[model samples]
Target: MDRRRVIDLEEFADELRRDPHPVYARLRAQGPVHRVRLPGSDPDYATWLVVGYEEARAALADPRLAKDGHKIGATFLDEEMIGKHLLATDPPQHTRLRALVTRAFTMRRVERLRPRIQQITDDLLDEMLPRGRADLIEALAFPLPITVICELLGVPDMDRAEFRKMSTEVVAPTSSQSEYDAVVRLAEYLTGLIEDKRCSRPTDDLLSDLLRTTAEDGDRLSAQELRGMAYLLLIAGHETTVNLIGNGVHALLTHPDQLAALRADMSLLDGAVEEMLRYEGPVHSATFRYAAEPLEIAGTLIEQGDHLVVGLTASGRDGGRYDDPDRFDIRRDARGHLAFGHGIHFCLGAPLARLEGRTAVGTLLQRAPELALDGTPGEWLPGLLMRGMRSLPVRW
Candidate 1:
């Protein structure tokens, strides 16, 4: 009999936060799958982390790994607040939710925002560029997507400062009780916001559309589903893109060769954005997927009821999938990366995210030609879910 290896991620929380790829690389050397305990999780709970690219792709679409919150029982966050969204459900339900949201988040609709996205980018840079130095995360990364998503959803009165606090707590909770409290507060805020939207003047916003839109079969989002959808859109919309811009800029500025190449030839912007996503995507790992039944991944047996984490970051940097996986090369053939995930649960806001990333990075580089890291970034966000620095200080 062999003893199974246990990697306590909580033990190396700080190190992993700063640079998870190195740790994931070491784990990949061991095997494709490892049993690990995430930071802030209860001591006894463990999840299977799929680090290999092939394995991760398969695990993401594995039917045996269920996304239903009921399958995993009670969690740190309130079920009503987080459940019933696209990521938390499987098939039929997921299929339906995706369909409804997609109608509003269509690529055509996102494309229409190109002008607005560019304007926002220019306006933000206009304000920050004059200072010659600023925390890029604050000056650009965080606000860009939050502002876009809020307007898109018709959330006119949201308090970005306070909402950000609640959103951060919901995603990267410091404790179980803290997460519960945050979710409760967020749920209350969202509920109130939805009601306010209802009472206020009608507007041409996604949320307003969602309120009245229904399927051919007359399937419309329930009040709870509406809240769940709003929570997902608001948090995921801002959180993922913020990190994408922040992480993408950090990657390029650190890799002078890549940055220089991009600067010399603007044609590489698309590939650079793809490479940024592959190299350092916003979401490090997908949310929890519990085993619906006994399953095997990369030859490792996973018992029923066991939890699993699809390592989006690890999969992107899998040595087996790409040459020099750790090196940041904007020109690499970076297709097939699982940065936005795979199968039915692919990020609904991917188009908007890409639009924002391309506009922000391209415009920033064009405006601030001498942009460089001004100071060491603050600690990385604490959690396996979101991969981002707390703040990235930079100067032109």
Candidate 2:
């Protein structure tokens, strides 16, 4: 067992926060799975981090690696306050919740928003381009999807600045107390938002549609379920796309050849976005997955009740899967990457994210022909869950 290394994950926090790729690459070389502690976690609080491409793909769909917080002895997130959202539940329950949300989050529905999405993108660009230089995260990357999701969910009064803080903390909590506080505040806010939606006259927004939606058995989402669904859609919808835009733009700006290739052929936009997700997906690791029973991943034995974090970013860049995995190639096939994840929990909003990503990146290139990095890299989000830049400075 000496071949397997036991390292304190916190020891690598600063380096990982800057660019986790190198660390992940080194770990993948040793093995796909590792026992490590997360930031702010106890020295003894090591969990399994799956970084190999194949191992991560299988682990994501593995039933033994469950999402039920109760099964894992979790101390951070409370299912009652958060409700059993898609990420926090398993099949049967997960199956039902996904079915309900999928009814309103259909691809057809998302496709219909293309024109409006373009209009929003164009309008945001108009405001951003004139500034000549700006932090892309604030100016464009963040606002576009937040606006799209808010309008989609019938949330017209969203405070982007406030929501960003709570959402970031929830995704990568610094401590249990901070996580609890943010979740409580967010839950309260969403609860009020849902109450208002229920009392108001029905509208065409997705949230309203969900309010009136009924299954074939005449079933409907409970008050808590509605809150959970709203919370999931509002947060997950915007966060993933935000980082996708930021990371994708950063990748392009840093790699001129690939950027020029994309600029030469705007048709490569779809593939380019796929490449971006594969190269550096927004989610560094899939949310907490706990072992329901003893199991082995990549030959490493995981004990029952052990927590697991699937390395979505590591898996996408695995050399065994992609030739020259580290190289950013916009035109590469880039298929089968686990950026949106795999199996039942695959990202529900992938279509919406892809639509937004393509529009945001493609249009930005068309408008800002001379777009370039305005400064050196900024700090990356410090956690195993979210992988993205805090801000991306850019100039046209």
Candidate 3:
């Protein structure tokens, strides 16, 4: 890497994890795209980090930036550990996988899940509030989504602590060996779940539905594909919401005025959730997209086989997108934010995540009228991929 051309992002990792907007602003001031070396990556190699709003938005959907690493003669570790799931594939395959999954994961289906989501929220809060003080992430944020998704996937009760460990290793790994072990364990677990579903009578769950789902031309997800899909859905289904609730609540507690405004008018629930997604979304960047062919984005020439990340957090702070983008106002009309990303790979679990966020935040405030930060929020999750706390202590 040319010292003049490559920006060393590893130097900014600590600051980015603590508070990324300042770093994002600094990068954006220079330009939308930059050759940056991320933490744990080869110093000699660099990735194009897209930070500008318009550029990030367009880069997300641009087919030239292929989601399939294989197209560029490479593959992400998870894709190899699991298989070619939606985030790891381009059109044709993605189109097919999406269509089948969409049939089961419809908006109408999500709407029907509101009552159960609320019940889960109420139950979690009921158990948590009486304690007077609790780590919000452990007591609520993490459990709610995990419970909902586990039930949705018809996964039988298992060691959740173990599961979370594996999931974290895959997403925000501390070591390569640990990550590989986690992937192997998770892949094995998912494979078992698939086999169980395959042998057992069909159930009213996404996993079982995927097992029976077939296309007009008799195309069905093979066993390996089912395992991959299960791994994707199970992980993506809850992890995003876990951070959504954690990050959103932390934002609210930190900004008393916004928290007060939200309490005054519960009607702001919808807008507040949207604002949460915009202000401090769960993920900093969408999954890496590779340059399948040479292309230019925001005047930066990206050669074929180049790896890049679209900065969702950076885009949300772009002055070009929202006036006073860094402010934490719940009433801001934050539609079209790249929090859930843009285009085809936009989060499929977005509706579910939004619903859970709305229910979790609104219910928490209503129940714990005196809810406040018990202490400084714990350390943020390591790595730039996820933006959330390892713990957020709070009290009523």
Q: For each candidate, how many residue pairs have backbone atoms clashing (under 3 Å)? A: 0, 0, 0
Error of 3 at 367 (Å): 0.3
Among these predictions, the greatest TM-score belongs to 3
TM-score, candidate number 1 = 0.96
- lDDT against the true structure, per candidate, is 0.88, 0.89, 0.89
Once fitted onto the true fold, the runs of candidate 3 whose alpha carbons sit more than 4 angstroms away are: 1-4
lDDT of 1 by residue, 121-223 (tens): 8999999999999999999999999999998998876678888887888877777777788888888888988898778887888998888878889988888
Question: lDDT score, residue 135, model 1?
Answer: 97
Write down the TM-score for model 2.
0.96
Q: List the residue pairs that clash in candidate 2.
A: none
Q: Write model 2 residue lDDT over 263-372, tens digit each, in one string.
A: 99999999999999999999988988999999988677888988889989889888999999999998899989998899999999999999999999999999999999
Lowest lDDT sum, 10 consecutive residues, model 3, at 1-10
Candidate 2: where are CA atoms >4 Å away?
A: 1-5, 174-176
Model 1, position 288, has a per-residue lDDT of 84
